[model samples]
Target: MYVIHLRYTGALAEIDDALDAHRLYLEQQFDAGAFIIAGPKIPCDGGIILAATMDRDRLDAIIAKDPFSQQRLVHYDIIEFNATRLAPGLNLPQSS
Candidate 1:
């Protein structure tokens, strides 16, 4: 699994300007089953995304296509971790 942290590098106006395109990209990822959960940060400085299991390289490539990334409006930090524990009712793919 992975957690993606995005920090805006540009002004809020620029961020707002790209929001629609950004949302479209997010929707596509969700439809492709790559993203689990995503939303803006508490302070609205950026956003967070929880992703399904996948290679780091593949994930990086996917993020590279995001509108924010393309415009260089945000910085990305990717963290990978084993799902040693899960909440009830949450079904995550397990390694064989």
Candidate 2:
């Protein structure tokens, strides 16, 4: 699993301008089953994304195309972890 944290580096106006493209990018990722969960962080300063297990390089490439990234409006932090445990009925991404 991976946790993708995005911290805005530019002004909120810039972030807002890129929001639509960012959302569309997320929606496409979800459609492709790349994302498990995603949303804005508390206080709305940035965003968080939970992604399926996969190659870190691939994930990085995908994130590099995010509108925020393209516009250089945010910084990305990726954390990878093993899913050693899960709640009942919760399914995780299959390892590639």
Candidate 3:
């Protein structure tokens, strides 16, 4: 799985201006099964996205398509890790 941290690069005004498009991008990714969960950061300066395991190249391509990237509104840091433990109700792809 992956943890994507998004930090605002542009001003609040610019971020707000791109919110709609950014949301649409998120919706698309969710629909495509690329994202598991996503939401804004508590301080409202950034956001987080939990994505399903996938090829690194593919994930990078997906991230590149985010509206925030296109608009230069945010910076992203992606972390990939092996999920050694899962909660009772959690379901995710397993590593061989």
RMSD for all candidates, in order, please. Answer: 1.7, 0.8, 1.9
* Clash-forming residue pairs, model 2: none
lDDT of each: 0.92, 0.91, 0.90
- For candidate 2, give the lDDT: 0.91
lDDT by residue (tens digit), candidate 3, 1-96: 899999999999999898999999999998888998999999998999999889999999999998899888889999998788889998885421
Clashes of each: 0, 0, 0
List where candidate 1 sits over 4 angstroms from the true fold: 93-96
Model 2 compared with the native: what TM-score? 0.95
The candidate, 1 or 3, that scores higher on TM-score is 1
Which tens-of-lDDT digit does each residue in 1-96 have in candidate 1? 999999999999999999999999999998888898999999999999999888888898899989999999999988998888889998986421
Better of 2 and 3 by TM-score: 2
Q: By TM-score, who's the top model here?
A: 2
Q: Residues 2-91, candidate 2, lDDT per residue (tens digit)?
A: 999999999999998989999999999998888999999999989999999998888988898898999999988889999899999998
Estimate the overall C-alpha local distance difference test score of candidate 1: 0.92
lDDT of 3 at 65: 94
Q: Rank the candidates by lDDT, best first.
A: 1, 2, 3
